[model samples]
Target: MPERSLILRPLPPFRLDLTVWALRRRPENRIDRWDGRTYCRTLVIAGHPVWIAVTEERAPGAPRLRVTMRAPVLPAQAEERVRQTLERLLGLRVDLRPFYRQLGGDPRLGPLIVRFKGLKPPRFPDLFETLVNAIACQQITLTQGIHLLNRLAQAFGRRVKDHPEAPPAFPKPEDLAGRDPEALRALGFSRQKAQAILNLAEEVVSGAVDLEAWEDLEDAEAIARLRALRGIGRWSAEYALLRGMGRLHIFPGDDVGARNHLQRWLGRRRPLDYAGVQRALAPWRPYAGLVYFHLLLKKLEEQGFLQKTTC
Candidate 1:
């Protein structure tokens, strides 16, 4: 199939960073690897996968952005959906105009302008691979969970290309429909994890679960539907809703990292329970997802996840 390319100009800085951060989480999403030049990631849209690459190069006039998107799907409608997905992921429509005006004159927040200058919300997958990996990881350490996901991908996912360094695309529902549960078990998936994965796959294959449509639903409805699945509960549902549908208000309160960060941010002596989390985040409203991302970034910064980037 011939590839189609689209260029996006003046991309938001925060959104670009967010996209890079997300792609770094898993190898399958690595769309390009050019040191100090460009970064890229792949995403599946309308069942057709595509690569998006962005680079900022010094130009004679002004700093220029070069964005190249290569996809098999070519219609304007499909392109529009991809564009909307990027916008939604980056929270571009929320209009921080008021916040900018309010803080423009404030001394304390003035410095934050430089730090947070062009930060934008990130784009992520409709179905969160992390959430699924987390459910399979329950009570296990981060290392164990990552290993399990790697194994799962190797066992069931397809090898679309043999890029020696990059992992393969995770198996789709049909890829695992006929596999024996024992196969996953042997791959170190707990019995419960195997069951949940199989159940999810069956739901996907049977058309009982529609991730795309679910992405457009309200948070409450989306969470309710996710929880209806046998293996998915509050944590999994919230995680999935946040990643899958961009529902910002729903927090996986069970995440120890989130709880700890909230504790410190609120100056609370004790850990926060679910209700406490809800109350604390009430002020953030519809943009709670952005808040969560910020908090996570803050925690990562504190923990030395990456060299502290200003703001």
Candidate 2:
């Protein structure tokens, strides 16, 4: 296999680790690897596993990211897959200038936006991966959810290397489609969650459900379609909308953690409910989800989960 490198230029002041941490959610996540200077992950690209290492050197002008892709294909094919994957996973193409200008000089959100200046909202590679993630984390602590996902990945997904110790890529629908429900349950998934996951995978594999097609629909219609799946509620649907479809307008009003963060940030005497969150975020309009990411980074920094990314 030949290793090829591609350079990406993000807007400016970009931090890959910040976005990686938000997506990985826990230090136990094996698929998303970030050790100070570079971030690496194994993704199944065109049915073959590929390992990509991304690092941005401290340079003047715009930030530059070097993507080294290890794969069996020629340089052209490997670079294309790596570029597309990086575009989606690291949000390389998203322009945050509008978001920055919109909240400029605002008291509460202004400081937050400035604090996490280099942060870019990340997404799962595809809608199925996003849905499965949302399903696994529903009504549970993120740490526990990540642990379950780690076990599931190790059991079902293919390893980046032939070695037993290699990290596995996130599983595909076909990978989980044939999995036994009891196996998932044994991995700490509840009976209902296991059934939901199995059913969702089967539906996707059988062509009965088209989660990716939702991207072509309006936000309201797409969210409705997402919620139509079994075990997917408002929170899960909104989460899928933002993290899966990259719809930045949605803030997931029912998210207790986000609500708590928003309330505390605003110094509200009472907790925010669904309507309250909606009202509070109305001013941000289509950029409220960006605020969610900012708050998440703030929480992570305050709790000491943010590691210095300089080696």
Candidate 3:
């Protein structure tokens, strides 16, 4: 089959490179691949594996993207599915103007926000993946966590047979629902984590849970419901709210790395606990998650994985 192409116009001040780096976080993330120019990812669409490549045709403030997809059989509505998924994943339609205006004259976070103007808060395609990520990353370094996820994807995720070089898509619930925990354990998941992933997958597959339904609930209600699940806790629940539901006001205060980033960026002498994180970020209410994303980009830039550019 031939590759199908489409044109997309994201809101201005959108830089695909910056947005991708924010979504990918590290160069080692196999699931989201960025090689200087184009951003490529394998996605499962309409029961077929598709390889997608997106390139920016114009700079920020007049942004345009050329999206190309190659699949064994192009499904009906494939273009629309790809468009909506990319729009949500890349935050193509989100306007950051109000956020920028809110940061005016702020001595602490003004420069940081200005430095990474086009970065958007990216999300997992669904709650199942978000929960899996939170479980995989609990109490571990991000690098190790991403390695475990890559292994999971390589093992159970759908692959495009035609493009062996492209990484496999993140596993869907059906892909993992019937697997034994031992299988996940072999891929570097702890016993508890393995079981948690399997349990969530099974719940999704059996229709016992509709993870997407939480999108309609308020933040507190959603968090409460999420915490009722076996493996989810405060941090995981909050992380899901921000990353899965795109609730920009909910910052995962219990995230040690993010807390450290906030403390250091604020020049606090003492290390911040959850309470301290909230108190310090109270002034930036409703946009603290945006701050979290900006801080993450700053860290990635410092580590040489990404570079700052004008929007």
Candidate 4:
């Protein structure tokens, strides 16, 4: 396959960290790895695997990004899509709006703006895997959930050529629908989780559920359809909607992290209920999804959820 290289001009300051986070969440997605001077993750695009690399290069006495993407499937238009995706992940559009005027500005939040611009939401496939894994991982630690997801992917996902490092493709609905529910249990799935997967698989295989169609629908419409599934409730539906469909406004109301962040950011001693969160976030309309991620990132920083780095 012919290799392609495209320059992402005037790259946003936080692009590197944002891309790294998306790549790291699922190691199987990586087809190759390089570190130092330039960092790159080789991944599959449009059924063909490709390598995406980024580095800071000095040009005209200023730092600029040098990005290289090699994939037969990297369409000419993909650069724009990738940029939009990165922006969505970093909460760039959501954090800057004047919507949160009610919450008095804190000088502390200033430093966060730069860093916040780099926080990319996890990838869509990873998000789906998380939802499935979370269902399998109720009351379990983060480590356990990851292990289960790894096992599921290993057992059911298809392998891609020339990408030994790439994760197995998630099982198609038809592939899983025919398998015995206990088969998944043997792979460490709980009975409930196994059943849910099968239910989802059946819908997919029977054409009763269309993942593609769901992706194109409005957020509210998508959530309603997801809720109709047996194991999917409001939380699961919102989780899937945001990650699966890229709906920027839906936040998982049941998440403890989300609740805690809202309380802290708003300077409220008590947690905000669903209505309160909605009301507080109303000004950020059309960009609520980005706001939701910013809150999570802020909480993570405050609680030392990850290592501190200059944004």
Candidate 5:
């Protein structure tokens, strides 16, 4: 199918760059590509491969996304997936008004919310990708972890020939499940990490683990379920809760990078341990994850690593 552009009317205060950055994490991310003005990715929609490039413009007092989708599927079918993907990745329906009204007055987090105004917390395409990402990032620098993910994508992910830069979708469970751990180890994963990935994949494939069922679970319950899995610890579980399921209040308390940001934001002299982080974030209730996203943007801005938008 030829490329087609459709419009998506999002709730007020939506910034594509902020949402894309939150989803993609780093400028080097290959799965979600942002070229400043637009965000591009190749998604598997209804089992059909599609390429979508998304941009936004203001319309009649509301923000709207201009989505261009190209694939072998019909435009109408592709539009539905495009809309769904944007809603998931950009958090279009997530109402931050209450959070803003509550935390917007805080001395520490208030300025952060202002700095990254219109920011929305982003989630992985699926629970499987979220778990895979957490496994890859365990005890490693994020850059290295993402490199491993890129290699893994090139190895097993599928793509269309429509666009040269269409990032291959993250590999499916069928692609990784039952594969030899050494195959993943060859992509620079630790042996244990490789085995863990394979195990999780197999479990998902075998119906032993239903990650999507966590949607009906509370944050604590979801965290406990994720932690019960081998190779997933407190940080990994909490991280998955936030990034995988969009549990916006569940900040990965053990995240070193987030801890650093929290410490600096609070002007603390020493680093915050997991308990300290919990204490500091207690008043925020379920919005500490929002603070994490803002701090991530602050770091990227300070380092001049945030992607540039042409529009």
Candidate 6:
């Protein structure tokens, strides 16, 4: 296996650590790994499992990332695919300047923005991964969800060619479509969730559902179509929109943790429901989802999972 390297120039003020934290969410997440300096993940690209390691170059106003990839045999488009996937995963192209200008001077949010300057809203590698994540996390704590996903990946995901001990890539639809629902149940998924995951995988593998096609649809339309799926609901649909399709306008109102985050951040005496969340986020409009990520980082920092970086 030959190793290859490339450089990615992200929009300035980019911090790979913060964006990776937002992507990994819980410290327990095994799929996306960050060991203080570098971020690493294995992806099954063009039928080969490639291990990617990315590190920040730390330029003052122009940040660059160094990406090193190792695989048994690199496909012709491997670098391009890996580059595109990393761009989406770390939100390298998302210019938050408009978002900054929108509410930079606000008393409460200003500090949060300043505190996490280079943080970007990250997305799952693809729509299927996003939906699978949403399904696994339904009604469960994020840590538990990540644990289940880790188990699922270990059970079905493809391992790197030379590193059998490394954590496997997240399972693809083809990897799980023909799998037994009972096997997922053995991994601590409920029977309903197990069936839903299998069904979704089958649909994706069979070409019965074109999850990528949702890219062209508006947020509401996409949500409605996603809700039509077996296990997807309002929250899952909106989550996919924000995290999968890169629609930053969506803040999953049904996300309990986010609602609690908002309630606490807003200093609200009463707990906020879906409607209350919508109302509270109305002013932020398109950037509300960005707010959600900021609050999530705030929660992570408070929990000691994220360290304060000097600005």
Poorly placed runs, candidate 5 (over 4 Å): 74-76, 307-311
TM-score of 1: 0.75
Q: Provide the overall lDDT of each model, using Cα atoms, as 2-decimal numbers.
A: 0.59, 0.83, 0.88, 0.57, 0.84, 0.90
TM-score on alpha carbons, each prediction? 0.75, 0.94, 0.97, 0.68, 0.94, 0.97
lDDT tens digits, residue span 40-158, model 1: 44445555545555666554543345556565454455556656655655454545555446554545434444455555544344463534665676777655776787677667654
lDDT of 4 by residue, 1-311 (tens): 34555454342334444444333332232222224345554333444444555675556643356666555456665566545543343233433234234222535444455566545444444334435744755556444655776677678765545645444545555557878988889988788888988888787778877676677777788778877877777777787777655666677776555666767877987778878877876665656666676666665455553343311
Error of 3 at 42 (Å): 1.0
Kindly list the per-residue Cα lDDT of model 6 for residues 5-47, writing each as its tens digit: 9999998778888899899998888888888888889998898
Indicate the worst ten consecutive residues by lDDT in candidate 2: 158-167
lDDT, residue 191, candidate 2: 95
Best candidate, lDDT: 6
Q: State each candidate's clash count.
A: 5, 0, 0, 3, 3, 0
Error of 4 at 255 (Å): 1.9
Candidate 3 lDDT (Cα, whole model)? 0.88
lDDT value, residue 272 of candidate 2: 94
The weakest ten consecutive residues by lDDT in model 6 span: 302-311
- Could you give candidate 2's per-residue lDDT for residues 211-273 as a string of tens digits? 878877898888788888999999998998899888898898998889999999889999899
Higher-TM-score candidate among 1 and 2?
2
Clashing pairs in 4: 28-167, 89-121, 248-289
User: Which residue runs does candidate 2 get wrong by more than 4 Å?
Assistant: 72-76, 163-166, 308-311
Q: Which has the better lDDT: candidate 3, or candidate 6?
A: 6
Which regions in candidate 4 have their CA more than 4 angstroms from the true location?
Answer: 1-14, 19-111, 120-143, 160-164, 283-286, 299-311
